[model samples]
Each structure stands twice: as C-alpha cells, then as structure tokens.
Target: MTRKPALAVVGATGAVGAVMLQILSQHADVWGDIRLVASRRSAGRKLAVRGEETEVVALSEDALTGVDVALFLVPDEVSARWAPIAAAKGAVVVDNSAAFRMDPEVPLVVPEVNPHAVRVRPRGIVASPHCTTLAMLPAVGALHAEFGLRELVVSSYQAVSGAGRDAVALLRAQLSVVAGTELGAGPGDVRRAVGDDLGPFAAPLALNVVPWSGTLEEGGWSSEELGLRAETRKILGLPGLRVAATFVRVPVITTHSLAVHARFENEVTVERAHEILATSPGVVLYDDPEAGDFPTPADVVGTDPTWVGRVRRAPDDECALDLFVCGDNLRKGAALNSAQIAEAVALEIGPGAGDRRGLGSGQGPGSA
Candidate 1:
C-alpha cells in the first residue's frame, strides 16, 4: 500500500492554528505523520490533533525535513522568511499570510472559488486571501460565474479576532472597562474608558466601530481594502475588474461580515441570485429578513460555510444586486482554507508516493 503523505502544521499554537488542529481532528485521517511546529516558546507544548497529543517542534529546517506538505498560519514576516525555505525543502507550502498572495509565481487559492488554480504553483506556494476577502468570495464567485461580474463595492464589518490574539485580548480588556456603564451615549465617553493599548487596531473596539483596519496605502486605501480588491480580481480571473472596499473593525470576536454590491454584465434577479448561492459549494443562502432570518456574525461563527442573506436587486439598476455575507474569519477565512488546499495536495500525492522531498521543482501542483 502507498503510504499517506506526511504533513507539517506550522504555527500550530496560534488562534487560527488552534482551529486548524480542531479541523484536522474533525476531518479525514488522510495524513501519515502530522508534525506540529511553532515558535521557540511554544515548541515544547502539546496540542491535540486527530485525537492524539502531538508535541510541537521548534521551527527549523529539520522540523520540515521530509514533510510532504507545509501549512503556514504564521505572520506575514514569519511566513515570508520561512515559507520559501519549506518550499525549497520540497514541501508544497500553503501559506495563510500576505507574503506571497500577489506573487505571480504563487497561486492565490480559494478552494470553493478557484480550485483548479491550485494546479499551477510555480513557487510551490498557495496563498489564501485575506479574512475579509475570504468571508465573501464564495458567494461572489458563484454570482460572478453566472452573471459575469463587472464590479464590486463592499463594506466589511471585521471581527477583532481577524487581527490576531493580541487584538482579541485588547478588545476584551476594553469591554471589561465599558461593560457596566452607560458610557457610549456621551461623546468622548468610550475614548476615555479604553485609553491606550488598542493593540493593532486604530481605536477603541469595544463599544465602537473603527472605519479603518489596516495600514494606509496609496490613494488613502488601507492595505486590507486593497488586498480585498486584488484578491477578488485574481480569484475571479477578472483583471481590470473595478473593486472598492472599506474595512471596519467591529466588536465581534470571530465572524466577519460584508455588505456587497455586485454589478454584472447580464441583468440579475433576486431569485436567480438566491438560487445560485443556495446551490454553491461552501455557501449557505439564508435570506428571509421578514422572519429575522439573515446571516449575522453570531450565527455564522465557528462555521465553515459562507452564510449569505439579504439578497435583492439594486432598486435603481437592473443588472446590480446587493447581498450580506458572514463567515468565520478563523475558519473559512484562514485555517480551513489552508487545510482544504493541503487536502487537495494529498489527493495528488495519493498512496505509496514515497519520498516527495524536493517535490516542488516547478512541477505541476499534482506532481507528487
């Protein structure tokens, strides 16, 4: 019998890493040896995966030696520095950072949206889109497939967790400060309560919503917003597609939500859009606002599918539709997508494909 592929779960102790472990435990036992690797401080710790206590090895060349696949859930800098090393070592790297998203050599993959693109990785790396972009792409891709998507205008209500553990902790701390008092009604009230320590966010995120979420970019666009635009166009295979996005920080802990306005070359209707979303893989259509049945962050957290609701044609335009979408940032938006890509690689490796080391030599994605 062919042996199963060996897998390395890099960044195995982070927030998204925790979810990736849970997903591995919950999903199929397709892997042979599941190696866990993290920072030096987290190296000796044990994490539960596939119902076993796996001790994390410190990130090093030896840790990734002989691994068939490496799933990177680390920061952009860490991924930037390490992912290429892993790729050089012959492990197909599925990176969840912004390190290689725009690199022409690396394919930015959203399994539900563009699974076929996974096959052409010149860099032996697959980049997952930003959490906000992932939160809405399944539905958008589905609609685009049917309607020839021409443009997109989206506003994202992002959870603090998307910013990472420190941001989550900061939000919790601020919440504790403003939980009991009726403080938000007055001007400067929330500002005085959650004074400094906003973590990665620009302002207080407990009783407030900050319109900014990423570093400022050219033309006043946040990096996150520009990422949304770039990732959308690439995933949809639509170069020169017009996309405008505004990312905001909300108090939610896990799920990210988006309000999308999509314009299509062909006329669209609410019924057709609903039907498309309902049938699309990795998407759930939940549009029944009269009965209070619409996608919300609370209802969608910890889930894998993108929940879409509030579907309607734009009142003034026959070819435009509006939608509200919600998805778990840590799940589909990060860990889950990376895991899915790894699974795809596993399928290519199949059984008995021994010694895949140095396998990513400009080979086709399925070249095991």
Candidate 2:
C-alpha cells in the first residue's frame, strides 16, 4: 500500500485557514494524515476534517516535527518566524503570507504561471502571491504568451474579508447601524453614526467603498498596491515590467475582481485576446457585453477558477487590451493555491518526501 504524506496547516482556525481545511477534506483521497495548528488562544478547539472532528493545536517548533509539508495561512509576522523553523525541521513550507514573497531566495508562485519556480526553492519555502495578484495571473500569463506584455494598469475591487475577520465583523455591525437609521430614526441615532467606532478599517465599509487596502508606503501607494506590482513582476518573469495598481476594498463578503488594462509589445486585437483567454487554463472568458454577460463578485464568490469578461481594445491604443476578471479570494487566492504548491513540492521530492533536517543544513534552491 502506498503511504500518503503527512501534512500540517498553520493558522488552521482563521478565515482562509477554514477554507483550507474544507478544500483538503474535499481532496482527502490524495492527502495523507492532516494536522491542524493555530495560535494559543485557538488551541484545543475542534474542527471537522474528512468527516472526523480534529483538535486545533498551538503552533510550535515541536508540532512541525515529522511533517512532510506545512501550509501557513497565518499573519506575515507569524509566517516570517515559523516558516523558517518549519523548513529547518525538513518540512517543505508553503507560506500564504507576504513575509517572504519578494525575497531574492524565495519564489512567489502561481502554479499555473510558474510551476518551475517551485522546484528551485532552496529555502524549502514557497510563497503564494497576494490574493489580488493570484486572481489575475492566469489571465495575464495567457496574454503574455500570445502577445508579449509590456505594461499593466490594474484597479482591484477587493472584498472586506481580505482585511481579516475583524474587518468582516465591522462591516456587518456598520450595516446594522445604517439599516436601523433608515427605518425612521435620525442618522446620529445609529450606533455607527454616534461614534461607536471600531476602526478595523479607516472608514465605514457597510455601504461605502474605501480607496485603500494596505497602508501607504514610501511612493504614496498602499502596501496592497505594491504587492500587486511586485508579485506580478515576479510571477510573469518580468523583473522590469511597468505596472501600476490602485487597490480598493468593497463591502462584498468574498471574491476579488480586477479591471486590467494591459499594453503589449506587439499589437493585440480584442478578438485575438478573447481567443487566447477562451482556451487558457484556469480561465473562463465571458465577453458578451451586448447580452449583459460579464464577470461579477456574486458569480465568483465560491468559485475556484478566475472568470474573465468585458474584453475590449483601448479606443486610442490598439495594442492595449482591457478586461475584467474575478475569483474567490479565499479559495484560489489563498488556501487552494498554497495546497497546490505543497503538491508540486511533493511531486518534486517523490512520494516518500518526509525527510527532516536541522536548521543550518539541508538547504534547497532559495534558502537564506
């Protein structure tokens, strides 16, 4: 009988972590024994896995021992600290945070775009791209193959869930306040209107749009915007690519959508762009504008694949193509993508890939 590799999931109690568990359960026939790990506060909590209830354990160095692969869906700081420890213990770590994405040694991967990069990871750590970038990678990669991409101008309509669980709660509470006020009460009578301010976000997200996601960096761009620029260049193998982004958080529950305007090195007609996207792996083109067929957040909330629609050519620039794409930020954007990276590493190291090593030894391709 063939032995399935043992796997561990860090942050196994949070939003993306829960989705990771669900995806793993759905694919149980392929996975081995699964272990759940989280912060100390969430330890000893029971979570369902493959029809059995499992306890979530606190993440520690000892928990990583004997594990074949560790999937991290925790905060950046937690990942920055624990990922190295997990890698040192001989487990391939597929991190779903921004901790090491742009590191020279670490590879920021979207499997459909750059699977080969996963193989050369010397750090034994593979980083998943930002949720926003993952939503658009397959589409951009397809276009790049057909007509070399030169520049990209993207505007992301991100969901509140991207900010974490607290942000989701804030949105819900704010909505309640707004609803109460609309029912014959004055604006100041609502909890939110009278400064029951829980600042999980900069502004009220219940019925409003905030033009920022991450905090602003040196260049006046939010960290979320910078992530798009960096991750896109890394995945597309265009280190010097010209890319600009504007990321905004919307009130939607899940899924992220992008409005991408791309200019190619050579001329790319709208017809040809649509044809390439139609056959692209992990992409569904729905470009019948006249028929009101287009991708929307509602249509993609729980979907794994990125949906593409509204394909058109820029009126002034024939070489530029504009498209709208959407995908579930929690699934493909985080959990599923991290799991796919782990699977790719397992394939590279053979079925029995449970060899453990000390911290200072057993270095791989992108090791520190």
Candidate 1 lDDT, tens digit per residue, 1-368? 45688899999999999999999999987888899999999989988899999899999999977888899999999999999888887778999999999998889999998999888887788888999899999999999999999999999899999888988888889989998899899998898888977788777887889999878899999999999999998999898999999888899999999999999999999988988998999999998979989988988999999999999999999999999999999999999999999998888766543433334334323333
Top candidate on lDDT is 1
Using TM-score as the measure, the top candidate is 1
Q: Kindly report which residue stretches of model 1 are placed more than 4 angstroms away from their true locations once superposed.
A: 355-368
Per-residue CA lDDT of model 2 for 50-126, tens digit only, reads 88899999999888876778899999999999999998877788999999999988888888888888877778888
Model 2 segments more than 4 A misplaced:
180-198, 355-368
Worst 10 residues of 1 by lDDT: 359-368
